[model samples]
Target: MNEQQRVMQIFQAYREVNQAFFQVMAKVAQKHGLTPLQLIVLRILKEFPDIKLMELSDKLNLGNSTTSGIVDRMVKAGIITRERTESDRRAMTLKLSDKGTTLWEESNDMRLMLLRPLLGLSEEDQQQFHRIQTEILTILKTIKGDVLHD
Candidate 1:
């Protein structure tokens, strides 16, 4: 194959791998009684506790209306709570409830399971995998304009 065709093949393989990974995550999330997006919300809330709707929307690259609907369903499921701040009592913020925390922990364990076998690799291979995954993540983050600030 020509160099251009080879590059396109690599891209296609990468896309297929990503799609398969997401599909697996979706199935796992569904088994845990949460949609994939809801599981994401829980994890993000764990990292950025009590984030506001607009900020969460921005972080997820989703519209405020769409984010709000997701938040509403999570609240109904007792997975999250929306509270008002003293500074702006009219505006609500997102927080993982105790149940949400438990669910997040559980879902996180499931997510880790997908890559857990990598830990059992020989030390050299494990280190190489770690480095490669980290580099790939950095590249993807940069491409998406989600560069780490610190």
Candidate 2:
């Protein structure tokens, strides 16, 4: 195949792999009675407890209304707590409830499941794969603006 064709083939393979990975992750999240986005919210709250609504929206790359809706549902489900910050009573902060914390911990198995394929690779191959993935990410970020313009 020509160079361009080879590049397209590789891109297709990468896309397929990413889709499969997310499909499995979604299934696992569903099993835990959480959507994939909700699982991500739980992760962020665990790492950055008591975060503000706007800040969480920024992290999630979502609009305030959308994030607020997600937060509202989580609060209703008793998985998260929302309260006014002491320093800024007008603004609210979010935190994972005790149940949310336990759920997040239990979700550790999902991480392990995702990593299982990579763990099966030889040590050298795994390191090489990591290096290649990092390099690709750096290159993509560098050209992202230029690529988006088209």
Candidate 3:
């Protein structure tokens, strides 16, 4: 096979892996009465602790109104809380509530359960896998290959 065909094959494999991972995450979220998007929002909030609505919208590539709607539903579901600044009531911030935190922890535990076998590898193997994952994440985070840097 030519280089192009090999690259296509790799992408195909990557797509399948991503799909499988999404399915697993969806299932886990469902178990906690959340949709995949809701779970994603929760996870993001967990990582950042507290973030403004506009920032969340930007990060998710969603509109402010759309993010507000999602946050409303999450608040109703007891998954997240929105607080208005005392100095500026119009400015709202989002954070995971206690219930959401518990849910996040449960989901993480489930992930660990799923990966326990793979994580049983030798220390060196674990370190190598971690390093490879870091590199892949860094590449994925780059903006369109930074053409100007080339």
Which candidate should be chosen as best, given TM-score against the real structure?
2
Cα lDDT tens digits, model 2, 77-147, are 99999989898789898999999998888875776776687777899998998898899788888799779
lDDT of 3 at 72: 93
Off by over 4 Å in 3: 121-150
Clash number for every model? Answer: 0, 0, 0
Backbone clashes counted, model 3? 0
Ranking by TM-score, best first? 2, 1, 3
lDDT by residue (1-150, candidate 1, tens digit) is 999999698679879978988897897798889998998898899999979999999989999999999999999999999999889889888899999999999888887887687578799997887797788778878977854553
| Global lDDT of model 3 | 0.86
> In candidate 3, where is summed lDDT lowest over 10 consecutive residues?
140-149
Report, for every candidate in turn, its global Cα lDDT versus the true structure.
Answer: 0.89, 0.90, 0.86
Candidate numbers sorted by lDDT from highest down: 2, 1, 3
Whole-structure CA lDDT of model 1: 0.89
Highest lDDT model number: 2
